[model samples]
Target: MIIKTPTSHTFVTGSSEGYTPLNAFDGALLAAGIGNTNLVKMSSIVPPGTREVPITELVLPPGALVPVAYAAMESDIPGSMICAAVAAAWPTDPAKPGLIMEYHAHGHREDAESVVRRMAEEGMRKRGWEVKTLKSMAIDHRVEKIGAAFAAVVLWDL
Candidate 1:
């Protein structure tokens, strides 16, 4: 297999409802503008020198394999809430790779968001790196029948 290091990254979050759990997940992906692409779930690591991009400036072709660190939650219980979130902490040292953290739970967006952000900070702390910049995104859904929430830090190249 070939390995490619991404050049840039972006954050995305989306919530959706559907008839089934998988459908709800798909809808959430679609709502996040990342549907139709293969999401290759990757571990939390932002390569050194990589920069952040606006979600609108990033695009993926259908059927392409995309690398991401993500959190996802799905629930079928009506009126239940689900939240997903992700955070990226860039190290103050440009030579060091940054860290990414993901979290999902049956809770409000604020709860999930806070957890993921702290996770990022803890990861950087473990590495003895100080965060130069921190970025995050989160989404929550209220289930009617089936619902899903998804958040991700997409790593990509031009």
Candidate 2:
């Protein structure tokens, strides 16, 4: 499910007509066994409604050994379950050459956002994804924000 973090709403209302690298990432993780075996898909829940938007709706196998982030409104951090949720929430768009998954994270204590960012960067590096270019993506964390939160994005070329 798409957890609308307190940080930004851009990812919430963004266009639905784009590729979904998030789906690719999910597939990769599952294949690598970084997630559970009974993971459910959530791409259909992007414009997450009230009750259906819950993280459990996008269930992945629990007890993952990986570092799972905490659940917070301001950030959709990359816990193993959240990653599964992201993979589930991911949708495929033909507009781009690849798929994309975008979300945010909260780091109230220590550098939570920074940690997630580093993990993503390192994970990508381990996967051998060279930085082709840096594009300015958009996110809308509502006003009156506190603590540390950051937008996270992933893309993959099919």
Compute each candidate's TM-score over C-alphas: 0.96, 0.24
Candidate lDDT values, in order = 0.91, 0.27
Can you list the residue pairs that collide in candidate 1? none
Over 4 Å off, model 2 = 1-110, 133-158
Candidate 2 at 101: error in angstroms? 8.8
- Can you tell me which runs of candidate 1 are displaced by over 4 Å? none
lDDT of 2 by residue, 95-116 (tens): 2121223334322322433343
RMSD of each: 1.0, 16.0
Give lDDT: candidate 2, residue 26.
39
Residue 77 Cα positional deviation in candidate 1, in Å, after optimal superposition: 0.7
Leading candidate by TM-score: 1
| Candidate 2, position 119, lDDT | 44
